[model samples]
Target chain A: MSGAFISFQDATKDYGSVRVVENLNLDIARGEFVSLLGPSGSGKTTLLMMLAGFESVSGGTITLDGKVINDLPTYKRDMGVVFQNYALFPHMTVARNVAFPLEMRGEAKAVTAAKVKKALDMVQLGQLADRLPGQLSGGQQQRVALARALVFEPRVVLMDEPLGALDKQLREQMQLDIRELHHRLGLTVIFVTHDQDEALTMSDRIAIFNHGKIQQCAAPREVYDHPANRFVAEFIGETNLLDCKVSENAGETFSVTLDDGSVVAAHGLPGLVAGDRALLSLRPERIEILPAETDATATGQNRLAGEILDTIYQGDHLRVVIETAVGQIIARTDRKAQEWPVRARVMLTFRAADGWVIAP
Target chain B: MMAMSLFKSVYATLIVGFLVAPLLVVLPLAFTSGAFLTYPIPSYSFRWFSELVENTVWSRAILNSLLIAGSTTVVATLLGTLAALGLRARNLVLSSQIRTLFLLPMVVPAVVLGVGMQALFVRFGINSTYLSVIVAHSVIAIPFVVISVSGALGGIDRRVERAAESLGARPHKVFFLVTLPLAMPGVASGAALAFATSLDEVVLTLFVAGPNQRTLARQMFSTLRENISPAIASAAFVIIVGTILVALLLLLMRRRSA
Candidate 1:
């Protein structure tokens, strides 16, 4: 945090008397592609706007390169922003749009022309440089906007759900394109998006936001595998939560008693105790279904007896829902696995290390 | 449905005839060879048109009209555009009240405005001058500019301005480069309306202008009161044709921009 390229210290935003972003602190290192992932009205976009100087900070300080930038105007902030709708100038040609920033900086005409060509080439829009923004297709227009934003060579690039308007295929392609660009240029990018998969795929680290506060901020694998709390666990992906009472606390792991009187060991949070109610988050893919006659007592795995309730085919996998003693548990199996007929007796098993215990 | 369609056509034809009746009567009389303003047309000639061009008084009045209308258009457009920008401010208090105040001159009777302006200009010692007449014309013309510019500014996406700022354009540069270019259509049409408004002004001109500052409308009024000549009809023909030309030019401009 001491060498942070951008830092928000107790930042707060209020519209009139209603506070939207409350007492937030975050540090983004140089060249890090950090994403603020949240649903609508979660203050993610507000934080981006504040950093870009489009919106003023109501409380605390935002620093860039160790200097307070709370009062800096947008033009002086040396930041580039790509809006959701592209926001390309309708009157200007594609090349002119990319050259706008250089022109604003009073660059030499010959230099500006060459830089514009290079920027357009970077986005592969060189052939369409003469077309107006209105004449270009949506994807082409988006590329032109990207070229314009990156042409300025700003200190930071803030994207506000820039691909939200694109189709799924185009959005995916753009995600890859932006990630490659970030890596090639070593750009510090702060992306805001509500799509969890997009965040997981594109971000170096994702800050999960809820109710104007960060629920958790960590690497994608860490956040997905060991979510800090129930909200993050539920928000990040689908998980089967079992209500249980902690019967034994052993620092890194604990044993919890389920509603059906079955004791199962689970990974534990820091402050968990022996007599506290908790929820165990078990990912569906981690659970393996086997025949009722199979014996797994020697494997040191948590076991449950259940009957097949339903089997939903998911193209690549089969989502088998088993009516177990604790509750209905879901397990994913390869689509080519043996047919799991309804009402068939089965045994479900998962390793203790795979079950994460979270506070209610 | 057939009967409704017939009725609509009949109503439209009647309205068109009612609007064009005066022009039908006045246009032919512009070329009348007779001395009086009668519709029977004793003879058809370009005598009145020739007289309009040959007479010094008529030429001076036409020049004065052009000078005043041109000046009024420039002054009204500058002030009206600034007012529209101010009215577009976010969280602006009394926005509606201020807009209504800007538009008040449009609804107020011309005679009432003329009386007030005459008194005010006399007190300021600028009575019966070209400045007084142009100032009076711009007061009413500004509302047209304001309405048109405001509509254009309203249609603009605010994000485009933010886009410009993010690309290192300062506030003034953004206005001159991005905002102004996007709003040019409205400003162009506003300017045309302002010119047309100033050209058609007569009641205010009579109250504030001197004999030397007489405009075409003022001259036509005095000529009508003194001697009802066919030259007055020629002047009316000229004014109507000039207005149509301005409208055509505006249409061409809008088409190019679009």
Candidate 2:
């Protein structure tokens, strides 16, 4: 949070009676590529639009570089923005589109040309400078949009699902290219997307949003490893939540009794009492599956007995659905392991610290 | 099957002949060697065309009509485009009402508009002058431009303008840079239609234009009253062809741009 480049201080946006973004407060550091990741109707795009000055700030101020820019016009605020549709001017050539901001700012023609060339070269589109937007492919047009946003050397860039229009392979390639460009230019970027993998791959920090609220904002690894709430835990990745009752509470660690009368120990839960009911979030990949005849007498903090209901081969991994006494749980295992047929009995084991209990 | 297609072809040709007969009659009559307006049997000659060019009154009238039509096109196109932009964004109750009011000139009977315009011009002390004619022409032209440009604006993606604004262009810049260029074809077609409408206007011109501001249509009407000259037929032929050519050019421009 030190020396933050863009700060949303208690920002709230309202449309009539519905509040789209409510009480959002976060500090995005300089040169940090952060993503506002959420589903449709989650107000993540609304928040990004407000920062880009397309939407009015119904309440609270958005400050950039210690200056309150909420009242400033979009152009005066000096920020670059790439839209979801890659809104390149159809009438302008690639070079002209990239030079638009410089022209608006009254830069010298020579300076504009040089900067435009550099930006297009950065996106590896220098040879296509004279082509119109309609003449280029979707991926190429998106790169032109990125180049246009970067040509003026704006302090911050806002991208609204910039890669949403591309195919899977091209989207992945552009993700890396954009990330590399961000690193080379050292510009603050606020990327908005609904794709979790894209956010995980490109963002330095990720803000998980739900119901117009930021559930957690931290380093990508931190958010993935230690999600702040139930929404964050389930949203960041695949998780298996087991309904359980708190059987014992000792200091920071607690023992929970599952529906099938099995007890599991976990740590780092707050406000847990002996009778409290909670959901234990266990990542599917974190669970270790063993053969049915494997030694059950071995010491283990958490274990479950189940029958394999289904096995799905997902290229390098196998997704096995086990119907335990508590409920159905999914475990991801390497495909190279011995295959377990359907209806086969199995034992699932994991360390106690692997599961975190979230309140109902 | 060949007989059926031949019948269909004959029917289609008859329909086209029905549409084009009046224009066909006028074109050849313009080149008639006879002094009177008759079309069946006449030697082809440039006598009428030469007379149309030589007559100062007729040539001046044609020039005046061109000036009026050109100015009216410019004024109506600008105002109509502005009105369309306002209507698209504002959609305010008053603006909508005003738009409907502006369209009244198109729907109202030409005689009624002419009489009303004449009275209004007299009261304002500018009757039968070039300004009065230009105003009357613009009143008819604005609605065409408005409807055409508005259709184009509606087809455009508003996201492009928003994208431009977010990428550091102001509202005005977005309109000029993105909205206007995208809508150019529609605006051009609208202007062409306005020019043709003004050029062919007779009732309004007769009521509002002064002696010095006589338009080609008004002159043709006067010539018809005094004498049935082949020169008037020649002028009619030129006006009809010119309007068609302008319309075709507008269509071609739209196609090329597309």
Q: What lDDT tens digits, residue by residue, belong to model 2 across residues A232-340?
A: 8888899898899998888767899998888888763677788898888888998888877777768554788899999999998999999999999999999998788
Question: Every model's Cα RMSD, please?
Answer: 2.2, 2.7
Tens digits of per-residue lDDT for model 1 on A99-172? Answer: 99999999999999999999999999899999889998788889999999999799999999999999999999
Prediction 2 global C-alpha lDDT: 0.88
What is the DockQ score, from 0 to 1, of model 1?
A: 0.80
Candidate number of the best DockQ = 1
Identify the runs in model 2 with alpha carbons over 4 angstroms from their true place.
Answer: A249-252, A267-273, A299-301, B1-17, B90-96, B170-172, B222-228, B248-258
Residue B62 in candidate 1 has what lDDT? 90
Q: After superposition, how far is residue A55 of candidate 1 from its true place, in Å?
A: 1.0
lDDT, candidate 2, B107-192, per-residue tens: 99889999999999999999988899999999999999999998898878877787677667888899899999999988998899
TM-score of chain B of each: 0.97, 0.92
